[model samples]
Target: MADAVTEFVLTPEQQDLRRAVRRFCAERLGEDTVRRLAESGTGHDPALWARLGGELGVLGLAVPEELGGAGGGLVDQAVVAEEFGAALVPGPVLGTVGLAVPALVALAGAGLDEDLLASLVEGARTAAFAVPDRGGRFDPALVTVTETGGALTGEVRHVVDGTADVLLVAARTGEEIGLFLTDGGERIPLSTLDRTRRQATVRFSATPARALAVGAGAEQAITAALRVGGALLAAEQVGGAQRMLDRTVAYAGTRLQFGRPIGSFQAVKHRCADMLVLVEHARSTAFHAAWALQDGTDDPDLAVAVAQATCSQAYQQVAQESVQLHGGIGFTWEHAAHLYLKRAVTDAALLGSAAEHRERIAQLVLDGASASGGVRVATG
Candidate 1:
């Protein structure tokens, strides 16, 4: 069997992009700025969104040039996600880059690619995926669709970046399930916990929709796109967990109690050490998944499953420990610890929980590998 994980060596271009995004975040969205952004009632700053999507072209990095993008791949997007995670940058980075762009590129076959990709690349518009309703499951076939000619009627919940420009919604029509681009859905109110990432319910009662092609490879394409998202999200969780661990360590070193730094205490040291272990493992898992996605050489689903499983737990553990280490301030609204905790909790449940991913990993392992390297479920 292959090693539980493999190491990745980044190309010079990939390294450069990672450095650029890291520097940008440090300069433009540092700790103080992140704190203020989280507290701000505006939810997300439109100006920052414009700079990221339009000026930086971050939104279209993964799309192909023929479809109006810089032609960067999932690895590039994962790099950006790391920076966002580190700074806790408040925006639709995951929704737009991770979910929306990939889904659209996969669904908008042939002729539609040019126009749709051009809009996204140019930042003239944005897109979102309306799947994983209130319960937040990726079972696409379960989404209900009432199709009436050019109109689609249904309700999609937990629609990330739903407040954005265009929505690529999943719907079932007759015997086929596919994604459609719609702009006429009525928005339902939602009480969101993460201010940085908004969630909402979309009600489509005869909403006009432009059907996107799903071809014969639709399910595979959608699953591929989602696995990429899952892998990138794992990277984000790893980054976030590292941040939490670093912050807690720094605080422990300086926070004096009984004439010595709190970090000197055995209990605090053990907690921080445990955090390091989880974060390191999560990093390995995420990096493995990223490489698997880029090369398309392994079961992307299994890779993402392992990555997500480790990441969800890593983030939760790191966040909880960071708060506990910080003592009183961590629970206060003025501190940034809670923000990390909130984001970590919300992200843990994204795509699937750690438990769900573990089940998937088991299923993939039990199914074994086909002659062509793809995983296959043994039937009969």
Candidate 2:
């Protein structure tokens, strides 16, 4: 696995691109701007999304060059996600880049809505995809949306970026589940702990729908999109955790106690050291998952599960410690510390929770062990 990760190292050009994205976020996503956007009723700014999609080419990173995309893959997206995570820039990037684009790509055989794909690639239209309930579980039985007679009737809960111009829904069709497309639906914004990243409940009753691709491989395609989404989200968490730890350390150094810097104390030093471990682990796991997904390794599912579980916990813990380490200011709503903390918790629940991932890890390992004649491997 380490060798696989070594092979996936970012090239100089990729590193340069990452720094460019950092600059983009720094210039456009200033602290004041982020605050204003967060406080606003609408979490997304179409103008900002356009600039990122068209100028930065972030939305099209995974699309082919012929499709007006940057012609990159999951690794490139992980890099962009890391910067976005560091900045905590709020928008529909998750659904547009992670879910919508992947779904379109997977369904290319059915002549995926090229117009929709092109619009997304050019950042002309935003999109959202809803799957898995708030419990972070995707079960066909739980899918409330039903398609009948060329119309979709039912509601989708917790649709990521459901406020976009397009909404792709996963619905049960006979014995198999398939993807459905719609122009728009009734979007009910859900009040969340983290307002930076918006989520909404989409209600569709007898709404006209189009089937992009149905029948075989549909389930696998949905899983693939979700796994990659989780991987990119892990990258974001790593960035956030790094920022939180760095800020906490800096604050500890400057904050005086008993006529000396608080960081000089053994307890504070130990906490910082612990935080460093979490940040490093989160980064490594996220990168490993990205590489595994890109390469389509034999155990990509396990890799995603482990990465999601490890990174989510690391970020949440680091966030909690960041708040505690900063003492009083951390508790204030105005502090960026609380923002990261909220984002961490929200991310943890978005796709799945730490405990949920752990359950998956256990199931996958046990099944693999039984199939492999009872040899249990470490969580790798």
Candidate 3:
């Protein structure tokens, strides 16, 4: 059997990509800009998004070269995603890159929707995955939208980036689930915990849609997209947790109490140390999942479940701790601590809660055991 887990290190090219993304975020996605975008109606800046896709080619990192992408893998995409999370860059990145693009690529496989994919890669268009779930779970079995004669009708709630230019919807027909691509839907934006991310209720009224995949093929595409989303989300959580840790440590070292730095206190020191431990653990699990997805490990589902479960809890804990460590200032609206804290809480519930992923992990392990009559041991 193949190794269940392997050491994952960034290549020289990936390292350079990371540095470049960091520099871009530092210069463009400052606190003021993030706040501005969050408060805006669309919660996105098209020009900035264009720069990220056209200039950096980040949106297409995981797409194949023949499909007009950068011809990179999930790991490369995760690197960019991590930076986006750390900077709290507000946009449709999670929906477009993490969900829609993967589903489209899987269903099309360079055979269909080439124009749409190219437009997305160039930042000329954005798309959202309309899975009918309010709790961030993407179970193809739960899809309620129905497709008939090439038209789709149903309502999907709590859709991430639901206001995008395109919609990739999962619809059912006579017990067979399929993916359909549509251009317009009645969108009602919903207020959410994290203003940085957008959600909506989309109603499709016999909307003409192009079928991407049907029956088993559609299920496979949806599953592939969800797994990729879960893994990349874990990487994003790691980035957010790391940032919270960095900020907390810096504040603790400078903030004074009793004429000595707060960081000098044992309690504060211990808290920061704990945050560091969580951040590092989260980083390891997240990147490992990315590698598994990219390399097609024997059990990518298990790896994704582990990463999502670990990273979600770690990010929430670190963000909450960062706020507590900062005292009253952290609770204020003007401070950045609350923003990261909100993002952490929202993200914990985004791709699925830690508890949910743990349940998935349990099921996957049990299934694997049942299939082989015993658990397969890792050889390397």
Taking all chains together, each candidate's TM-score versus the true structure is 0.89, 0.94, 0.95
> Per-residue CA lDDT of candidate 1, range 1-380, in tens?
23333335666887888788778778888767776775575456667767776677776777877778888877777777877787788766666677777766765554255676677667666667776632123565567865668788888777776776778777776677666778778876467677777777888988888767543444544565577778888999888898899899999999999999999999989989999999988987787777677666556777788889999999999999999999998999878888889999999888888988888777677656676777553110
Residues 235-331 of candidate 2 have per-residue lDDT tens digits of: 9999999989989999999999999999999999999999999989888888778877776653776777777898899999999999999999999
Name the candidate that leads on lDDT: 3
Clashing residue pairs, backbone N/CA/C < 3 A, model 2: none
Residue 221 shift from truth in candidate 1, angstroms: 3.5
Question: lDDT of all predictions, in order shown?
Answer: 0.75, 0.82, 0.86
Error of 3 at 169 (Å): 0.3
TM-score of 1: 0.89
Which ten contiguous residues of candidate 3 have the minimum total lDDT?
Answer: 371-380
Clashing pairs in 1: none
Better of 1 and 2 by TM-score: 2
Candidate 3 per-residue lDDT, tens place, 246-303, comes to 9889998899999999999999999999999999989888888888778766467778
